[model samples]
Target: MFRTHSFVLLALMALLVLTQCTSAPDRSTKDPAEAVDVADQELSLTEEKSAGDWLQEADAAANEVEQHSALIRAANAFQNEHQWQQAAAILSQLAPKKITHHSQKYYRLAKARWAAEQKVWAKVIEELEDVATQFNQREFRVLSLQLLSQAAYQQQDYWQSLVWQVDAQRFAEQRNTDTVWSIARRIKQSELPQQRPNDLALAGWWRLVDYHHQAMTHPDSLTSFLNQWQQSFPNHDAATLVDIWLEPPLKPSESELEAEQAPPEPTLAVLLPLSGRYKQQGQAVRDGVIARTGEMKNLRVVFIDSEASDIESQQKQISELSPVGIIGPLLKDKVAAWSAQPITGIPQVYLNQIDDEAAQNSLTNVFFALSPESEAQQAAQKINQQFPSSKSALVITADGSSGRRMVDAFTSSWENEQAEQPTISYFSEREDMKTTVERSLGLTDSQQRIRAVKIAAGKIIVDEQERSRRDISAIYLPGNLQQTRLLKPFIDVSVSPFAEPIPVYASSATHELRNRLGDSDLNGIIFSDVPWLIESSGKNILLSQWLELRNGWGLSLARLTAMGYDSVSLIQRLEMMNRMPGLVWSGLSGELHIDNSVVQRKLIWATFSKGEITLAKEADNAGSRYR
Candidate 1:
């Protein structure tokens, strides 16, 4: 029995060797027989070798064809084990010309994958550009198209991304139609080609996105437009995604229709910290709510102290109140705690936002906050509108999480409209502000050059010492009032007198009405803030009372008060706004609108002039005004 088993094993081993020898040679090799012989010899000798061992063999191979085969085998071994770095290293050593034609396709694919991992998007595109169309395997074709699409999207070539994504949907087994639609949505309507592409799929995607945008503002026209679109692209891949794309409204049942028609309950439940360290803030919010609802005769307001007990107890109190809609929880931790739980079917408008995105999936909740990130984003848009000629910007921010969020938001918004990435700098301490500003504006580099020239000449020969960079057309200062006050003057003096004056923009954090004297240094700095505080045209009796008592409540608390007023005003309109995302409400906070269950505000634009705040005429006339 032992002799028979031995003979069977030896016979199987011989068959494996024969199979390896008879395998087809790489297409890249001119001499197919020689390449196959070399591969067969290497396979027989290195049957138990690791990827590392194969790499060493490739480096010490007798000739170029042997080395190419060894390197491709090493890369495949490393990639199978998910050793990305090792695979990338092995792929880098391969010479494309020495590789077999069959192996050359895989070599390009491996190199493109490595580039994608490194986020070298341009390199990914370059590596795959020629071979993408030549791939015969469905998996390879699908992967190539998907990688190219992602690389183009990362490079902000939206049109190319959409084209590639549309092409990918054709070959993929389970088509990601959502990904195709999402890439299409990123493109602006005005940027779409007036003449559709000859590719039917690409043209269909363009028209669908265009029709969706128009349907948002004029929803009644969607059905007719969709019918026309289907007739034009009846055989297109996008036709399969029509139901998901339209997101048609569900028909209401008898009870649901009656509930919608019935009047909402008059009681409104509010959660606030009436007795904790934040009692003063709670009181200010309460005052604002009262000020807004004072004249409403049929309304009953219920105030629950959120800090008095745990979140569970607070929720119990909210249940007992059974109010029409709810608002408050004037702290972040409280808001986050509330968000962690399931919705109770009652509508809520949170005074603060939480970090958990999944918690905000419900349509019954609204996140409304005076977010620094929101202010920074609007500041970017305002700057773009105010200075249409400016292509680049310099952003200086404080060093912390808040600063990071502000800078990220500003960069994303700025890049959407401009071709260049804004230059960014950060300062950790108040004393570092001046140096940070100087370095950001290139004054430090300018001075270093002057000193270099003076040292070379053996005397102070240069008349001019420093000059700000001419490339920066605008500056964004996302700092607090005191920080802005300290940094503005340094920026003012750092620029060379010969250069054009760069316009500076700021967030609401830099705006305050309490100190006109301190604001003198902030002259010519533009900022966005809630209209209730910045503009006098919409002043009410409640706002007047707060202005009279400003000394007691402080400016920060006044902003919170305005938030509370808007929360009450939004209770009845939240559903309507959610349904019609294009609708805007002129509230005390700003031009309020709903976006993905969050209240987005377009604030009033203002600039400092003669030590006093004034409405920017350019903002009012240059299409920045919401109305």
Candidate 2:
């Protein structure tokens, strides 16, 4: 097993440089073939001789003659012994022209592989490009292209990566029996398409992939884009290929969709603090609920002022009204007070989330809120889902209870998904945010930077040397709009601009307010929120109309309005959801699914680019830098 693994390593580390070391003076005067034959015999007797013994014999044979075959044998033995540098050294010693074509190809590939291991990306690309352009064998060419694709991707030059994959696909298709098509398909499907100049094939292909990616989140736009692409690129092969995705989504049959189930309770009651300090919030909730239920024939909703000073008095008045199901009491204290009691015979949905340990555990009724924790969890989930390569996260959060909970929720959710535990840092003041971020990201390693600089005897030199840790693949900041805006630039400047950009993820708190100038600074930060807030598709007919009528609304209040809108529909389906655990209801808030009376909302995502907030699609460009 060790030998097999070693052989694979040797195959990959095949070397390429033009330089060669002169033969040793005491080298044997035997024919090159004779030396190789002896080495081959020693390799064959691996069971008799230890790997160390075989390596010594191969080394002697390689040094004795300036033979390509002998040198390759020595390199193979070195690789098998896990002496990667030694194996690379042997391959480097042999001139490409002196070696057989097969050995030469492996030699060059090995050089590229070794360079990649050293993070010498330029050398890796140079060698791989040589093999890709000069190699005659299709398999070798494909291998070179594959490595080049990876190399380009690592450099974040996704355009070059896609181009290489396209070339690989063409070569693979020529062979017909090769499975490289799957490789191309995986890359195309997973990567976001970038517009390529002077390459019609890629440009056309980009449209198809872009359409497919957008369609995942916006199915309504798919058919229109499909038609546009087909019309624009009439005879392009890429256009023909899009036919596979052209299949429209399957709609539920009229009977299945309209099938009669249990009718919702005749009377739905809304519990709101209509005449107290929380009047504005309660009114918004009431307005949203009323808009949705206004046209329903068999349904009547009673709006009850739930701000009665005595908790018992409020409950008594609610019970007297005799609502089949109650929605809200949009205050945390009220929800906590009610959660202490047993179920109130009537089904209830509270619009405020309670974080109190006992209150959370005691709830029998459905608890729904625009929870910061839930939003944090969803943000972590979406980041993990979108960028699987990003395992480690560096979190920068504020030093308050709410901020701490948001970070904890994010970390817990990420870790629960079996992702690595994130590194966390905190700041108490806005003034300390930059310093906190720099320290957490290891960007403030000034001592190390000073040591890295080469000082002159008398004069100062190399003043601007900096280094930052690269292990962090993503950054999670659960701050409000201002904090998010300030921290993003600090993060960007703290790390070396040459390093690969780590993706920044935040909860809805970051993007909650619609401030163009404020959001402009938050460009490239990916965050998740309720679909109703980000998407302008009018999926929620009544809610969209409400927003249109009210030109501008507070972000906090708007969320409550959505909570109210979903509450009405969710109440109607709560009984059915309990019966069918697998059933999910798509509401304005998100894709709503319930587990243990706690409604989990899988929110939609969006990112800020060029001062505009756009719905994030499942494409590579979703996280790409603004051009």
Candidate 3:
């Protein structure tokens, strides 16, 4: 009987152990993703050290032989990092140095100095006057004279800048067959004098060479100019100009190098495929460039239909007229065609940057009006500033090259802004993708911040059988209307799985999101974009002109008109600050901010609710938005 009792007790103990084992596995042992809910609910977004502040650090990184290069690089670094003071400090160091470099170097230094806003005219004039001396490098001297005149004009000494410009022309003409002749030609709106220029040889010595590079369309302009200049005056080195050319634009101030105006009757070739299927965008860009030409002097834009069957044919035709500059050929393919044809010794500012194949052996006097790649990079920087805490930025894109380009640009910007090496998760699709996301946030455990919060919000419920993990803070989803809409349900629904909510961000949250997903679908969702339209405020003397445009031109046309006015009027402000290069470029377009071609006209944070986007608040932040 005792033996039987012992056996029964041991069996009872074994049964009890089995019962406990069979119970729903405790969160501690169920799966790595099981406890993810608890983590996601509690994790808060962490702030990254401002990438904009890297300028100061980079400036401190400058060395001796590479002093100028170091300064330029540091400035570029600061601009890329958005470090305003660091850029200024590096630029200011050169301010006190006597102007000894060639006009090219001076031009470059002047631009950097101007960008840094340290006495632009003072520095420009200081170097220019030295070149003005007959003893200076002949071409550089002439260039300096013209640049000096510009500084003088900037100070409302129009007569002075003009006089100096004439002097520069005379000097460049003397050095005819040199690059300064082009400067004088471009300066004169391409209205070359019947009297061969006498001052072309005395173009920008050093500093001047570096300054106008920002406006150069053809990458070879500087290269070609330097090659000839060095050949002519090899004993007098002008190698420093390269440093100025590579210097980054000001981070705080927007110093887009634009000539005052192009001359009228100046055969401006409209190099766009106006007759092709892609003619609409080409036309749009052409219109913007053309309408503004009137604002410039002697600037008659000749529309050269680049709608030929082949780019080679179009190039042959375009060369005959030898327009002052060519704009458009909206498609890169068209540009590729034009690239095959050699330039007609005329300046060309392409609306887009040339590809490596074309740009490699392309003609002189060519440049990209605005490189989309550059703009994309700028837009990316803006994203980081606007949304610093964003973790996984989802890019819902259409399957195309343009979409890929946008993604690439966003990625570049994100990488530049990401100081912590934080990763921005990307998604490419057009359907329900909850499973993929759940895996990222943590399908099984809930301890990871992104996973835990995602799970807690019920956005991605880790079933008893899933696995997920994510090292992120937020989500970025950028795509077309359809792609964005498809992502809406997944984002909103995934969050629903948790008790609280996780922020889902996008580049553009427009009418498309609400129309498809419904208002409540993207309730707390956030997005940022440069709206096509917005209200404006400022002392606009041209407001009357704008009003007139409103009457004659559509809002789009008015905006275009505004662009011209702003471009012209901005010189006034730039002239006044002559030395205040470090200040931010704030103007009429709300903030008048631009990373590159992608200007941040306005960014309004909104939540979709009931087919309407409600602007949450006005922002005075310095950085761009999150992805």
TM-scores, all models, native as reference: 0.58, 0.53, 0.42
Residue pairs of candidate 1 with colliding backbone atoms: 27-101, 28-100, 28-101
Candidate 1 overall lDDT versus native: 0.74
Q: Which of the two candidates, 1 or 2, achieves a greater lDDT against the reference? A: 1
Per-residue lDDT of candidate 1, residues 1-627 (tens digit): 226675455334333332332243542334633464355323321246666566666656555676677766766665555556666655654556667666666678778887888888888888887888877767778888889989988876777788778888888889876688667756644456677678877888888767755654444576777788888888776787664545665787888778676656679999999997999999888988988889566899989898789888878877866687899787998888887783477888999888788876776788888887898898777776666664688899889998999999998788434346788999999999899989998888988888888888885567665888988878998888888888888888998898898888888778765652235667898887788877763355566678677665566787889888888877766654554344566777888877677888889878887777788776443321111
User: Residue-wise lDDT of candidate 3 within 1-627, one digit each (tens)?
Assistant: 236675455334333322332242331232222222221122111213232232232233222222233234444443344444544544455432322232125325335344434545555555545435543446445544655666665554433443465556555645322333223222221121233223432333322333232223333354455456555554332344334434564543233224324333556676666676755555555545544566566655666666665666667777766575555555666666555564655544444445454354322323333333444454455445545663444444455676677667767667423334433334545433555454445542443554556667785655442323233444555554556556666655444343345555555423341242235655666655323222221233354444454443333333333333333223222211211111123333223322222223334345555655555454356421110
Q: To one decimal, what is the Cα RMSD in angstroms of model 1 from the true structure?
A: 10.6
lDDT scores in order: 0.74, 0.65, 0.43
TM for candidate 1 is 0.58
Model 1: per-residue Cα lDDT at residue 142: 82
lDDT of 2 by residue, 1-627 (tens): 347676555434343211222334554555443344333223220234433443344344444343454555555555545566756756656655455444555566767766766766667678877567666656556767877777776655565666776777566635321232222232333344454446665566566556544544443475788899998778765543456547555775889667736544578878899987989889888877886687466787888788766767767766766576889878888888777773455777878777665554322377887788888887776667665674577888889998889887887778323456778898989899888988887877864666656453236656565767787778888888788878988999888777898888887776554552236777888887777777863264655667676667666777777778888877765643432223466777787755556677888877887877787777453442212
Q: Count the backbone clashes (under 3 Å) in each candidate.
A: 3, 5, 101
Check candidate 2 and list the clashing pairs.
Answer: 13-110, 14-107, 14-110, 15-107, 192-620
Candidate 2 local accuracy as lDDT?
A: 0.65
